[model samples]
Target chain A: MKTIKSLHARHHELSDTHHQLEVLNSEIFTRHYLPTFREKLKTSGLLPLKPTGIEVFQMNVGYMCNQTCKHCHVDAGPDRTEVMTKETMKQCLEVIINHTIKSVDITGGAPEMNPDFRWFIEELRKEYSGEIIVRCNLTIILANGKYLDLPDFYKKHNIRVVSSLPFYNADKTDRQRGEGVFAKSIEALKMLNKAGFGKQDTGLILDLVYNPSGAFLPAEQSLLEADFKRELKDHFDIEFNNLLSITNLPISRFLDYLIETDNYEDYMEELVLAYNPKAAEGVMCRNTISVDHAGNLYDCDFNQMLKLQIESKAGTHISEFDLESLNERNIVINQHCFGCTAGAGSGCQGTTT
Target chain B: MQKTYYDPADLKKFGDIAEYGQDLADKFFNWYNDVFKDGALSSREKCLIALAVSHAIQCPYCIDAYTSDSIKRGASEEQMMEAVHVAGAIRGGASLVHGVQMMNKAKKMLM
Candidate 1:
């Protein structure tokens, strides 16, 4: 029932992206005789992974979140103060206006916590009528009075609301997210349902994301989706469009957890053994560019979190965006990428394979 | 050489039995995999059943395998524990049911 602090607030060493990467690339991996991700990729003939194109332009609006989930890769929490300025939003708007990008994914500690979040979305709607995804931590809907109308706002913009509900029940969901997140999430879902977000023929898409609560791969997506649908309908009378099964990549808080629980070596081994070439080919980074709160760009969200900027010749900021050079750049990859390529593969949209 | 009858790692080497008896092992593995596939019972249900049976038989390797398998199949913790209770009840009942014969013998001798 107690709140946990973010790694940044606690001054945990893993908060340093360099330290996290070193832990991921530690000698224990080689000592255990596990193959490096790059070696595995090369064996699969996918070394020097390149971009297919940019289809989704993901923006991390800020790191100021209401809740500090245990497995957060971004380490977002209320204690954090980093937020995106309107100037940065304007720069992103210019890129959106110029590029033929089909989707814009907005994510954050709690993106709605940003002061200018609504303004940015309104501006995006004006110039770009593409698919806009808001990664809403459902609890945020009930976090404050001002956020009470988020569901209606989303429906108005025709936003695709992708929310994380780790499991269908409270015990499992609360264990991962927080003490009472599942209850809040269910309430939030009901409100979204009332707003016709997940209803049939509403033209409003409400997708739920499911990642394992511990150090393990998720069950098959379609099977898990069926279970979520049956259980939610039978128990809570809630409905949603799709369930995206995501594999928890070893990074940030999750990586710290692996070490603390002594599951690091075994987990990394599992991921290595389950590496799928098909999944690697369909990695979201192949067709996505991630923009940080400060307007810096990276190959994908994970890369952005690690500060692995894109290898584009054009430039690494939205103000100097160039699709041609960006498309030609090789994606920045590391051991953590195995999370995306293992088993059926995982991305923001779910399984890649 | 292993000092004990079981090595946790041996579970991974299960397929190696094919080296000694390829035909039998192949048929066994094929049937085993097929048996677990979705049919009369959902694979999730089968996994829970397997978990219970593994506990009844007290196979360490099987207990380890089915525990992870059950989670991977999306079997809830509550359902999994209940399955084990089912196995425990049957095993306990099997022993208790034999007491009827003892009672019948005593009645025959006394009467």
Candidate 2:
């Protein structure tokens, strides 16, 4: 009875609030919502801020991959034919040398699947000599006869490999990936470890990536990493450096999935209600540039999917890169940005601030 | 007998917002299969995060779906609890930061 009464009273309160908001919104404009005015008025505020240094260079070598993961904002897959040529990589080297960039992060469907994959890595090593990261889908190491030597190759360059092992179990792993993927992933991780990938102070920097298979943000990094460590140790004897819990952005294949499944509204509402300015302030776009397969630049990879192109052509086609224009470019954002600016925040490299 | 499913009431305010509310809910359901598409993160892992997030902001529907999802994702009792703690810390920090509002208000009145 009390619950019913309270609910009824709550309905009355909401109705009253809605009526007041409607009046205020009508009096103001056709907005029907007044809170959004602050956003429109943001430039008037003197909360002076500056962009963080581009310490990480997230370079997209291509969209080719050995596996097709659903949450992939990159939409990379084995069927993808996009590959960055050597000339484009050379241009990236030029930007790294000319700019304040300090690290090189190479990502793809399976960054290792490109025919020029080895050459690209070799060239990057010769030119930059800075921190170089490869986002490896561990199973790629065992995908086919062609990729069998990747574990060894990665160790040769002392590459900091950030791979994905969604969970330590077989059923869940297979459910997200495909059949027999969990066993192969375990085999792949063991191979990487033998090649000194995730061993302590072996200095190979083997981190794991974690993302929810549904419509919510990721859990915190430390706790999830701990659980992963314990589970992998007890069961499959897998070890790693860290677990990166990334929030799934609502765009592209993901947007299509949400609409098809009917969880779009609740998920978006959840994200908006959980909006955290600290997360916003520390969003990765403040530092990184996401390059597409064609070499067009975006503030972050997520924005790239939404077609939010950088104001200026920083690196147009590997053939024509303008560092001056790249540095002067303004980052684009949209409502989907709420994904990054919520809770503890998320990014490719893991938690931000 | 499941507690905390989806409530349109909580989401009514987000009705017209781009990429959220009803459409996003629908989108989430469709995207469920896509999210599990072969890649780095597991479907179960994704479900665990979804469920924890549901609890973090008190989304009953998400909580219900993700509770079953966490289990289906093969998340152990311990693992699920750990994810909850992660959400706990962030949500806690979020509230504590907003204490700034109370602090500023107090300072203004006192000073």
Candidate 3:
């Protein structure tokens, strides 16, 4: 008989191995621990999750990011080389144009890090008329000389920049992100402001994302937004259109933290205990389709990260999108679905309910 | 059917108090709601204060609730801990300050 050590046992520190973490996810989110997420939803009349519409097409360009945050579900970092090729981008563009997606969201380890990112966006601008969102980690804006003109580029294209800033101050923000990240993020925000990103009626919308730095659900969006607005303005003289409070999904680095710190079961229980049917109804997966760097499709970004492909007879790839069939297909879900349905509910656009 | 002084599960049933008696429970909830809202001090500040008091009173329920409340309300780990330290300082000083009475009484009798 042969035995393999659990990923948690094999390594003493956090590392990104999708399969390893996926195995852990399977083990941790089981019926023995609690009722299956689907069962919980069925009890509340929200089972058999299905798509509402494809209003947003979110594309994960790659797995390369500048900073490796502790709670990043994507496990994006500097070393990741899995980037979307020009061919895939072309296919994605075809889907966006043909489907006429109302909003096309681009994400990544850092979407901008993709070599074809600018080219793809430029090509996308040529045909797509809807809103384009870039999920940027602000540090990337100041990463190097090559990225210095990013704010200007976003402004030039009227891109709605949605960036993550864990907290308003250096201490908390830096602790969650990496060291000196707070300062650089501030400088980037100032640059975006200079480019008319966050100003009122500027038509250059800038949004900030806030996720809890530890094992907890985010506070009410409006109150936290007000606090962020006041603190950022008073201290850094920074400005943004709105703050989106997002729940940290239990996956990737966060899952490791929960398991290692002996908080996994408790955290899952909290999410299950706070299950909100209203939120489940408005889950982003219902309206958004996620496309990975490889051009494969999933119900949402969380599903995409977990390698859960959309199940359809036609196929789940950018080249073969049967919008009708996808609309009718059952949305694949697991315990991670709780992150989107818990409490006020979390989505790419912020609180669902 | 088991009975205990404290059940961790009961924390989730805190809102069920209104089920037993709606009138008084409603009043308590309304007052509690009003107290935590943004006033002269921000809600985050109120949470920090609540966190400190929760520690001083040493109520595990309050501590658990406010710890999550404070973090959710944007209180940093450092800020939250500092709030706890403030509670500790005040509590410690409270006992130490009473030492003056002991010193005065001893001086009057011995000196």
Candidate 4:
């Protein structure tokens, strides 16, 4: 059950140009949530949130994935044919090498599925000395013959692997991701452990990510990390370096879930009520730029998925790289930004606080 | 001019107890804050415990506060409901177990 295919089949995706997110145009989510969020920010003295600077360059390689998770904002899946061609990738590399970007986080339905994924990393390593992160969905390691050596590949390149494991147990994870995903994920983790990916002394980092199974904010990151560490270690002897707790933004399939369950208003209300200005100031958008498969730039991955390209005169495509103009650009925000500011706040790197 | 039981707004003004006796209220507030801080049990677990106890005591304000607090801290609706059930079972058991005492007294007196 690929995420994009399943979501499209279920929601009858409105337009291809909208990245299949046009179904989120319901007035209630847009009109109602925005006013409430604006009012809350007004109360918290955090009105008019603006970007700080970009340090991280997040690239979405494609929308092809092995698994279709329910809460996935990407709506990535196997049936999708979209992929980042070598030409666009070259443009991205040119921008990265010329700029002072600190991190390059590669993501996709499963970024490894891209034929040029390894070659691109190798190329980046040649020029960029900064951190390189791969947003992996663990099951991908066990998906096919080509991916069997992913752990070894990651080790050789010293790429940080950040994988998603919805829960410590199989039942919850399988229920969210797919039927057989949990067992495969565990097997993959054990492989990572064998490869020294999660070992303490090893610089090769392996971080697991957690997102709520339903419409709720994530629990405290530290506590959840402890629980995950204990359960995974005691049960399967799985070891990981860190756990990232991410808030589920109301976009893509998650937004569809909100609408389908009629929890859109209530969930938005919870986000607004839990607004913390400290979190807003540290939002990933303030320090990161998200570039989509077509080489278009955005303030964050969420903005990219929504097609909210950078509002600047230098042009939003990577071919027109203007670090000075991008640095001065104001971040584009909406009601959904409350997801990043709620509770401890959330971002690609986990809790902002 | 106005009389009502359990005003919803009273939950927000809970700190106003200091209005009557400033010293004791300050002590209570500090104690309350310390008790809820992260410790042997996380604030999240403590919120669940508080939610269960609120149901047992039938305190509307505690329920409202802890309901929002637990949700803000990431407790699911299902988990919250399960906690309330735990409280219900305890309260129900507390009443049911005393029947053993009633039976013992009845046998002793009648005989």
lDDT of 3 at B63: 89
Question: Order the candidates by DockQ, highest first — what do you get?
Answer: 1, 3, 4, 2
Q: Rank the candidates by lDDT, best first.
A: 1, 3, 4, 2
* lDDT (Cα atoms) of all candidates against the true structure: 0.92, 0.69, 0.85, 0.84
Question: Which sections of candidate 2 miss by over 4 Å?
Answer: A1-50, A313-320, B1-111
Candidate 2 per-residue lDDT over residues A1-353, each given as its tens digit: 00011111234332232332333233322322322323522432412222465677787878776665655566666656788777777777777777777678888868787778798788777766788899988888887898889988888887999987677777666665667777888999999888888899888889998877666666566767887999888887878888887888766556545656887666665666666666667778777877776777777777665556776654444445565665666566555666776678888878775
In terms of lDDT, which candidate is stronger, 1 or 3?
A: 1
Model 3: per-residue Cα lDDT over A1-353, one tens digit each: 11222223345344444653454456545653666688987987776887888999999999888887767787777656789999999988888888858999999889999999999999999998899999989888888899999999998787999999988888788777878888989999999999999998899999999988878889889988988999889998889998998998888778877877887777887888889889988999988999999999999998887788998668999888898889888889888888999999999999999
For residues A118-232, write the lDDT of model 1, one tens digit per residue: 9999988987889999999999999889999999999888899999999999999999899999999999999999999889999899999999999889999999999899999
Q: Which candidate leads in lDDT?
A: 1
Give the runs in model 1 whose Cα sits over 4 Å from its true position. B3-5, B19-23
1 versus 2: better DockQ goes to: 1
Please report the candidate that would top DockQ against the real structure: 1
TM-score: which candidate is best?
Answer: 1
Per-prediction tally of clashes: 0, 38, 0, 1
lDDT of 4 by residue, B26-71 (tens): 9999999999998999798899999999999999999988997797
Which candidate do you rate higher for lDDT, 1 or 2? 1
For each candidate, give the interface RMSD after superposing the true interface residues on Cα: 0.7, 5.2, 1.2, 2.2
TM-score of each prediction: 0.97, 0.69, 0.86, 0.85
TM-score of 2: 0.69
Model 2 chain A scores worst on lDDT over the 10 consecutive residues at: A1-10
Query: Which docking class does model 3 fall in?
Result: medium
| Candidate with more favorable, higher TM-score: 1 or 3 | 1
